[model samples]
Target: MLESLNESKKLLPERVAEQIISLIADRELKAGDKLPNEFDMAQQLSVGRGTIREAVKILVSRNILEIRRGCGTFVCEKPGVVDDPLGFAFVKDKKRLGLDLCEVRMIIEPEIAALAAERATSEEIEELQRIEDEVKELCDKEEPHMHKDIEFHEMLAKMSKNMIMPNIIPVIQTGISLFINITDYSLTKETVRTHQMIVDAIRERCPQAAKDAMIEHLASNQDKIERLSGL
Candidate 1:
């Protein structure tokens, strides 16, 4: 009977582990809170130690737990999603307000462009050109070019081939688009010129040149936003 019940689809080990994590979260378990030993926890939850171990491993990898060499596991001193060096917490909760998200992008996108300039491949450069061309074509069409514009920046970040970069790129783009859409500002001729400068720097493999171009592009964008919204 126990085995049959344990095999139920809804009561899987992962679910049980999630429940434990939720409990700790709800109870506001501080760092150094000692979780019950596997044996006792298994008996109490009617699940095996393996489930708890797997759950602990997930949290550990996410920096929520720290398994000591000889001592039992404990919550990390700062347990949360690891922040990228660039302060990348833009898309964590889907409920984040749009303006708050844009503020995050106002900080990150320029740097991503600079990195892409330093490391993008020929094929990636071609892709960015294609994205730019597609946007030009779309501008003449009935619909907006917002998605394509976002894709362009995202592709530029992917060109960098940095491990965590691709992940942060979309979050930044989403925020940028939030403001862009509200303001209805497609890439103007001047914006394209700035991007072209960055593209040229990338083609020449000049990291500093790319970085400066990106900074200028973003600064000009800020000026445009003020002109559009007076914010």
Candidate 2:
């Protein structure tokens, strides 16, 4: 149940949406958790059912909640930032978008690797190794390993153990994927080597080594992308 809203407040729907978002952030709600029915929420928030519906609609547009015809509303798995999360559509220069995304990866991922090294659970470490092995298998077969490579990075983000990082990394990665597809990129042996270096550093729990490895990896990729784009 929620607290009563201030009677003097205007825009009750917007305020209700803010409170609901706060509730999610406070962990009173979580991914895939079903929200109370609209009538109950209206009662709890001391608003009319129409206002509650409007608030739910707002959250739905933000990818925070989904309503099933008969099953009621449930929180999204990622909870927010759906559909072109980086706002690439608004950027008039797509090539600049690619380079900017590379810069972002260079900045954020190394620290994420460092955190994963410091905080990954033993099982999480094993999972990373498992993904690496899968990529190696694909590499050996000379198959398209890009999807597996993306999965490996995505899992590394999950292993970082930073609550907010897990949410943001996927959005950034989506931007990176767009850049990669635009460039028609291909994997290189050096890329595999760098990935191995990062995995080994994390496996040994060497945070600095993991961070350095990731920095090198992203820097190399940036250089390659720049070359391919003739920039």
For each candidate, the alpha-carbon lDDT, in order, equals 0.66, 0.83
Best by lDDT: 2
For residues 36-148, write the lDDT of model 2, one tens digit per residue.
78888788788899998999999999999999889999999777868887687788777778888888888889999999999999999899889988888887777777778
Q: Give candidate 2 regions above 4 Å deviation.
A: 7-10, 22-27, 180-185
Off by over 4 Å in 1: 1-103, 140-143, 179-181, 185-187
TM-score of 2: 0.85
lDDT of 1 at 128: 86
User: Model 1 over residues 62-175: C-alpha lDDT tens digits?
Assistant: 677788867888777766545442343444533344444555665676677778877788988887888877776666563576677677777877877776666776655654
- In model 2, the number of clashes is 0
Estimate the Cα RMSD of every predicted model relative to the unseen true structure: 12.5, 2.6
How large an RMSD does model 1 have? 12.5
Residue pairs clashing in model 1 are none
lDDT, residue 1, candidate 1: 11
What's the lDDT for residue 186 in model 1? 51
